[model samples]
Target: MAYDIKDVRTAMDPVDNQYHIVLIIILISLIIAAGISVLFTGGQGPGETLNLSGSLVEQDSTGQKEDPAETWIVRILWVDDQNRTYSFQDYPQDTKPDPKSYTFTGDPPPGAQAAMIRFLSWDGSTERTQGARYIMDPDSVTAVLNRYTLMARLSPLPTTTPVTTNTPAPSGTPIPGMLIPESGVVCRNADGSCTARFGYTSRHDHPVSLPVSDMNRFYPGEPDRGQPVVFMPGIHHDVFSVTYPGDATNLVWFLMDKQVSVGTVPRVNTSIMIEPISGYAPLEVRFSERSTGSVPNNPLAGTWNLGDGTITSITGPFYHRYEYPGRYTVSYTVSNACSQARDSGVVTVYQASYTWDTDPKNPATVRFSCTSTGDPSVWFWDFGDGYTSWEQNPVHTYQRAGTYQVGLTISGQHGKGSVVHTISVPS
Candidate 1:
């Protein structure tokens, strides 16, 4: 029998052919397995597992322990770089006379930057108290768990405290001392009005009830504008508020021998007022001297420390421009003869800018770079091609040659800002 050359070769190489076929089959199987794995895992691969453990104790300012029957609920919250929050909760065993210990095991989501641990104490079916929040970086989470462990001594809720009454002095020997008035805060309202809050410190051991009269009154308006008649012992903050027109001046409060003023002319007090305190850089801020209290022979003299390495002796309304993005503290101090007063304000400035370069060989492909200020932590890119990216600097390719609008937005600790640009791509 005569055999063809192909048949002769095939018969001699049957084992080799079989080996090649098996290898091809193995490669196909691996490809299919990889595809399935990606489909199930979303191509992100395995995540990092985190183990957290901590202890919590409930106590008040006086070091009084909480009830043994009370239980604490621990909440673990984490924020990713994109500002998304994820949470997990756990319960602590009510081991009285000792701090409650808790353990949490889970996978930390991708891009997690920070975490917070909050404790809520419960009594039966009702939550009794919410404790302090502990904040830490994600990188330090495991270290904190291993080294420090979660430990917090929280103050009990005010509502749960027992009320105690103080004994009054016998027959009232004039109550010993009087109340001191203080000007607290002057807040600007949105309707072009201003609200001035005032407080007082009572030196007496018992509550002093003083009717609204010339002894305790406000000037340049009604004597009694909801002023508190019954003064509680100890220091009280924002006890009463007086509203006035934005342009109103010389609002004063008198409590016996003590007096405080707001917007007084020939200003007896020192205060600084700033306009446009926060904005995008180059920010222009207006500074006005709200302190006009000058004596007959001693006039107020002051200097400004603008925080940006600049100091000036100019004593009138002035304007300063900040070229960089940052938080700047501006302070003014005035002193003459008897007293000195200082006032300070903070200015927050932010900036957002970017630059782009095109691929010389492929004009349709472009690379972007962010040159923003203020320490941006989050970035968003809009390519105007129906696709968006969260990357700080993203390279994109246009399908066809045309003009496209691109926008970049960034936000961080200081502030947020955005910019847009138009670009042309060549075919």
Candidate 2:
């Protein structure tokens, strides 16, 4: 039933041909209009236009000229109603130097839910990033972002829009039904053999030694944006939060790649030695400082307060002679960038006198008595007969008469003393 062209044309006539031509022209016009609509509107379906604008600036010493250079990069993320995320990056033009603010145009896809935006500082070798999240409003078309441009060295970026539609902005009180880091086996290694090895610098640049391998070791598996967990070695970093509905985990991002300080606080031990703890006038004493606890060396850099009103900026085994009989306190203080500590000791100086007598009843027997003028805290006697005694008075009987050298040493709160005498005995 296929008809030849000539037969078909004869049956149509001029009136039919003109009608078909008009229909063809109308169809072509409709197709062209649809293409134009898609080109201008990005083929969006039933949603408002999204206008995202922000500014980035390089850091200067004077806090002026906060604008990004031409080579910087910006990345933006958009989440649709289906929870599908779309990413746009490689926007070098947005970082033109010394220009007006940078802006992005987006057609909020039908059923769009949330959005996130971040800027990157790139030097063709390394990149620093700053990001913030927001709850997409189907009714609003404008979103604004403002924050410090540098990472780790500056403040966090701030967004004007809300992160969620139902939740009000954080006020004075905790929000109702707000989810926090969950508590379902935050760490692995059930046997408790795992050890904490890593540490990070906090926002204030203070080093926090982690008690575990990392914050994620407590988690059952890998970490995500929405897990309620507390930092170990106790909460030392800036609190940063992230929630990816796609992953369903709240990941904390406080390990902000900061420089950690090395070394430890310094500790010192002060020691004093006096030849005679109790003696006459003009007693000589020695003071020494020994570093006990430090990584490599002591961090203290302050002076030594001799406690006798003599402050010297010297780390010493220092010597001093006391001219008068009295009690003196010695101390040393050391300080460095990390911390400071002080150690002290005491020295006493006094007069001492002692004498011994022998028993005439038995020349081989000797009874020694301390007639010391100073009240000695302690007394020692060397009989020179192969015997020693700590008592103030001692009696010794020699097996045979012989020549002997007897010595007595005494110490008290004031000072120290020593006396030696020669004795002869006959059998």
Best by TM-score: 1
lDDT of 2: 0.47
TM-score of 2: 0.26
Candidate RMSDs in order = 40.1, 21.3
Q: What is the overall TM-score of model 1 with all chains considered together? A: 0.30
Candidate No. with top lDDT: 1
Q: Which tens-of-lDDT digit does each residue in 220-300 have in candidate 2?
A: 334443422332211122233221222323223222221222222223333434444445456776666664434332234
Superposed model 2: Cα runs more than 4 Å off: 1-95, 99-199, 202-271, 276-283, 289-305, 323-325, 331-345, 349-427
Write candidate 1's Cα lDDT for 138-177 as tens digits.
4554343323312222222232213232211212222425
Each candidate's TM vs. the true structure?
A: 0.30, 0.26
**C-alpha lDDT score of every prediction, in listed order:** 0.66, 0.47
Worst 10 residues of 1 by lDDT: 165-174
